[model samples]
Target: MKKIGIYISGLGQSVHQESIEKYAMRIKNELSYNDTGIQYDIKSEKIFYTQDRESTVVSIFKSKNDSEQELVYKLYDFQYHEILTTKFKTKNLLVKNLILFGLIIKKLPQIFLRIFASGGFDRPYLTFYAFTLLLLISLAIIFLIPVSIETASQLNFSVTIPEDIRSILENVKSYINHFLPISCIFAKIKEWLVPVTTFILLVIPESKTLITSLATEFACVDKYIGNGEQSQLILGNLDLLIEYIAENEPDSKIHYHCYSFGTIIAMDLLFPIGNIPSTNVRNRSALLITIGTPHEFINAYYPRFYNNRSPIMEASLTWFNVYSVADALATNFRKDMNRGPAEFGIKDVLLLPENINYEITSDKKMNIFNFFSMNSIRMHKCYWDTSPNGQSCIRLLFQKMKQQDFI
Candidate 1:
C-alpha cells in the first residue's frame, strides 16, 4: 500500500509543515470518523535527537489496510531553489531576468506538453499548439533584431484612430466642456488624482514588482528543467529521503500532492528533463494529485497565438486533477465545438465537458473580495481551503482519495 506523501510547491512557497498538516489533518479526521483513516503520522521536527539534520518526512505506519504495514513519506519542496533566487535577486536583476526569459523561451510550452502528453491529443487545433514555443521565439527574434536602414528611415506613415475611439475622445472632450465648473475643480486636484489612480492600479491584484517577481520565479523552474542546473536537487533530496526510510521503516510508495504552480513542478517530474524520473527512486511514486493546477489554463490560452512543437506527460498509474469551478487557474474545464446548419455551411463552437477521467470536483462559493476586479484571483489560491461557509475542498479530496474509483 502507498504510504509516503510528497508535497511539490509552486512559486513563492517554502514548506510549512503546520499548514500542510492542517490540510492532511482535515482529511484524516474525516476519514478516521468513517473508519478509513490511512494512519499516517505527520512530522516536521527531527526524530533523531543526536543528529543535527532533522527529518522533514511524515511517517505513515501500521496501516489499517495493510495489516501493520509501515512506511515513510517526505515533504519534498523545490521552492528552496526559488528561495535562493529571491535571496540574491536584488544583487543582479538583469542576469536574473535574462536567465528567466531564456528559460521561458525554452520551456514555457511544458504546460501544454503536460496536457497533450497525458491525453487530449484528439482535440481540435492540436497541431497548432504543437508549435507554440517556436512561434513565440520567432516573434521574439523579430522584435529584437535591429531594423534595416530602409525600414528604419522615417516613413510617411500617419497613425489613424478608429471612428469609435475618435468618437469616444470627442465625447469626453464635450463632457468636460459642458461641465466646465466641475472640470475646473478637477484640474485643481489632477496632480493628486494621477498618483492616487496609479497607486490604485498598481495595488489591484498585486504590485508591479510582486507580479514581476512571481514571473521571474516561475521562469526559474523552467530554466532548472531546461538547463539541468543543479540537476540532482530533487533527486538528491529524494535519495536522502529513501535512505532515511530504508533505515527507519518498511518501504512505501510516495504520493505527491501539488498545488498551483507546484503542478508545473509535478509536470517536470512526470515528464522530467533529468535522466532520473520519479520511478528511478527506491520507493517509486504511486500517485500525483494536483489542486488549483494551471495546466488546463495554459492550454486554453496557448491556441489563440504563438506558433510549433507543443509538448505533453503520459500517465502509467493514477493522476487526480482536482479543481474548483471558481478557480481561475483551472480554466480548461470544457471544449467548444459547434456546427451550424448543413445548408448554411458554417459552424458555431459552444461548450463541451472535458473528456478525460479522474478529474475530481469541489464546490466553490462566491467570494466578496472578487467583486472589485480580480474575481478569478481568490479562487486560484483557496481551493484547498474552506469556502464561504465551511465547504472544505481538502476534506472532499480526502473522501475521494479513499474511494476505489479514484484510486
Candidate 2:
C-alpha cells in the first residue's frame, strides 16, 4: 500500500527543499532499523503536481520479505514565518499596533466567554497569564505618554510633585531654571517627540525584534485559536492538501506528522470548528505523530484559546505524541487535563515517562536568563536527536506505527 506522510513544521521553521530532504533521510534511517523485518528506503523525492501544483512529495520504497511498496511523504507548507518575523518600519506603526493590541486584549474576556458558552472550550477558561502579559504591555505603552514637564513650567504653574519626589523635582526644576537657555531648547522638542524618541531608542536596538515577534505571535495565536483570519488561511492550505490526496491518491494511507506549534494547527485541522468545518481527511488519516507538542502549555496559560473538543471523529486514527521530559514546551498527552485516551476517543501513548530525564548540557556559559533564553527553548527542538529508553524518538515512532498496523 502507498503511504503519504504530511509533515508540518513549527513556528518560524518554514519547509524548504533542503529541510524536506533532511527530514526524508531521517525517517528513512529511523525506519531502516525496524525489528519487524520491514525496511523503508528513500528512492527519489520531487515536487508532485496536484490540481494545484503546490505540493512536495518524497517517494520511499517499503520492502518486507519479497514484497516491495512505495510510500510518499507530503510537506504541508503553510507559511506564517513572515508574519512571525515581521520588522517594524516606523515608530508610529509600533505604537499604533500596541494600542490596537491593547484594545484587543481589553475585549478578550468577552470573546473568551462567548467561545466558552458556545462549548468550544472546557472549565477554568480564564487566560490569566496571557491577559497579564498583554495588560503589562498595554500599561507600558500607556506609561510612554507622560505630561510635559516643560509645558507645566512654561505655563508658570508649579506642578504638584509627590511628597517623596518633591525634593528631587524641585532640585531638577531649579537646575533647569538656572540653565534657562538649555531649558528653552529642550521645551521646543514636542511632547510626543520626546516620548517617540525614547520609544525608538528603547525598542530599536535588540528589543524591537523580540517585541515585534511576541506581538505577532500573540496576534497569530489569538486569531488561530479564535478561528479568525489566520485560521482560515492556514487551514485552507491543509484542506487543499487533504483534498488533493483524497481525490488523487484515494487508496493511499495518510499520516500526519506535526512538530511544536504545528501540532496545534493539526489539532485544529482534525477537530475543526467555526469557519473551518469537518473534512473527510480525518477519516482518511491512519496515524498522527506529534513531536514536541505544546498542547498542554497552551491549555495551561491560554485556557480559553485551547480546544477542549473531543476528537471522536478521529477515534480510528492512531496518535503517537512524543515529548521529552526536559522540554518545558512539550507535553505528554496522557497527562493533559482536557485530553486523555479514555476521555477522548483515541489511543494516547506516553512515549516519554516523567522519570526518564535527558540531561540538558551546553558549551556556552549558563545564567538565570539562559533558562528563559533560546537555549531552554531549544529543548523542544532536541526530540529529533534525543533518544528515550535508549532508542531514538524516530525508532519509537516506527515501533508505534508498526504496533498500530500502520507500517
* Per-prediction TM-score: 0.52, 0.58
Candidate 2 lDDT over residue span 1-407, tens digit each: 65777877776322222244456666677666553666666654344434544655666667654665655344344444443334432335356457447655666675466444523322222233334344544444544332244444445336665665555555666776686654555545455555654664454353344455445555556555654555665677677777777777767777887777777777777655433334557567777677777665566445455345444544466667776645556665443332233222212322222111223343444454443243434465575543222334666666666665666
RMSD of each: 14.2, 10.8
- Runs off by more than 4 Å, candidate 2: 13-18, 35-53, 62-215, 274-279, 306-310, 334-375, 385-392
Q: Give the TM-score of candidate 1.
A: 0.52
Give the least accurate 10-residue stretch of model 1, judged by summed lDDT. Answer: 340-349
Candidate 1, residue 227: the lDDT equals 52
Candidate 1 has an lDDT of: 0.44
